[model samples]
Target: MNIASDIKPDRRERALAALAEKPDGVVEAIAGKAEVTPAEILEILPQGAAVIAGKDRFIDIWSEMTAWGTVLFIVHTDDIVLEAEGSLPAGSEGHGWFNIHGDSPIGGHIRKDNCASVTFVDRAFHGRRSCSVWFMNDKGSAMFKVFVRRDENRELIGDQLQKFEALRDRYAAS
Candidate 1:
């Protein structure tokens, strides 16, 4: 059985209702309140709000983001949220890991094999339009999130937004 499909109708309704009522609410907070994983939340989000692709697209997605200029790379846990602001470094696969090496502030090894899904999320965050790509593990937890950077006026960077939308469309179509 598909675990995501096992979520009760009421739970799905509640999640959707929460999004509708508080469009700017943080998804992680909503997931916590609704007792669902963030991945499950994304799955139930309204069409156009999210598009999920397979882990096999990991390298392709990351490669595309490398040219998006400065963006926010976030790793959130119960205790802390780590934010790194920089362009995604191009990565190479070797020795069971995807290693990122560059002059950027973010550089590390990612076990891409453990990634189950890559979700492109376009939602309102803190009352601002936000776009992010979430890399999620098999357990439905986000491994990391890369957000499109905003300008001084707090608007989504135009070119990056276009690129993000294009990527979402390309993957969502296939």
Candidate 2:
């Protein structure tokens, strides 16, 4: 989210700063299954999900003090991982394909070829710590990583790994 103004600050940025003042802008999350609007989600979302899910950025020490605004920070990552929301593999709709062809240098197909597991990975959950989710494509060559906490990201990485293996049972392989 872009809160930076060439000359001065923006309105949304000012509002976000005020929102973050106490207890980290308390009460900004939901449980069970629910749909949310993009506007309010900006405040409640955890940092990692915000960034990875393309939310605002807080990249500096005096970041919030000065800029203190949050709209959406545009980041240039080496590679962008697109989510396959509510879809299955091979059977999915558009895009989300890996470069697994013969001429492609990024060889090694995504394994586990279980369509059911693929769908589950795309689904987010109310992880104890946070919404922990790891998604490996059908071929399993590479995987996408996400966690609620940066330090703990590695901690539950194993759990998610195991969950990946176990999720095959949760859904019938498509």
Candidate 3:
């Protein structure tokens, strides 16, 4: 299910629509059921539910996200889903690779060549309005996702939400 090759376009769209209706729908689960990648699900999201930003513009978006304070960085595999909650470190780029390291445990050598696109998904999860920034690989599978984290009371962080919306609006408008 890493690729949507086996799924019909209409069936993929229907899966996305069904996922949208669930408050705590799991994108990976939906993608699995639809025989598609989570990134593919994001790609087919209805208008206003998501925004696409080309990989060429990712540097600018990455810069903005690095300053977004603490967030939830997720990296998943079939067996495990690792989540680190902290701020995105200031990354250094050299030799076509971006290296990130800081107080957060989400440091890695990001191969820019594998980045295919970026998607901003403004959707509800766990009964709350949430947003995720997904980095897709060349195969259109998500390499990782950076999501807005909530406060101690389990409430959404207004400032972060605003920033997410601003980023979405700014990029979508351009």
Error of 2 at 162 (Å): 8.2
TM-score of each: 0.91, 0.21, 0.86
Q: Candidate 2: which pairs clash?
A: 1-72, 1-73, 2-72, 110-138, 110-139, 110-140, 111-139, 111-140
For 67-132, candidate 2 gives per-residue lDDT tens digits of 212111111123553432111112111243322333222233333222111112222233333332
Question: Which stretches in model 2 have alpha-carbon errors above 4 Å?
Answer: 1-9, 23-49, 52-129, 132-158, 161-174
User: Can you rank all candidates by TM-score, best first?
Assistant: 1, 3, 2
Judged by TM-score, which candidate is best? 1
Sorting all predicted structures by lDDT, with the top scorer first, yields 1, 3, 2
- Per-residue error (Å), model 3, residue 11: 4.7
Query: Model 2 scores what on Cα lDDT?
Result: 0.27
Task: Name the lDDT value of residue 170 in candidate 2.
Answer: 31
lDDT by residue for model 3 (28-133), tens: 8777776666776765555766687888866788889988899999987788899998898888888889888888877888887688888888886767777889
- Candidate 3 regions exceeding 4 Å error are 1-24
Q: Please give the range of 10 consecutive residues that has the lowest summed lDDT in model 3.
A: 1-10
What RMSD does each model have against the real structure? 2.2, 17.6, 3.6
How does residue 32 of candidate 3 score in lDDT? 73
* Residue 41 in candidate 2, Cα distance off native in Å: 5.8
Model 3, backbone clash pairs (residues 3+ apart or across chains), number: 0
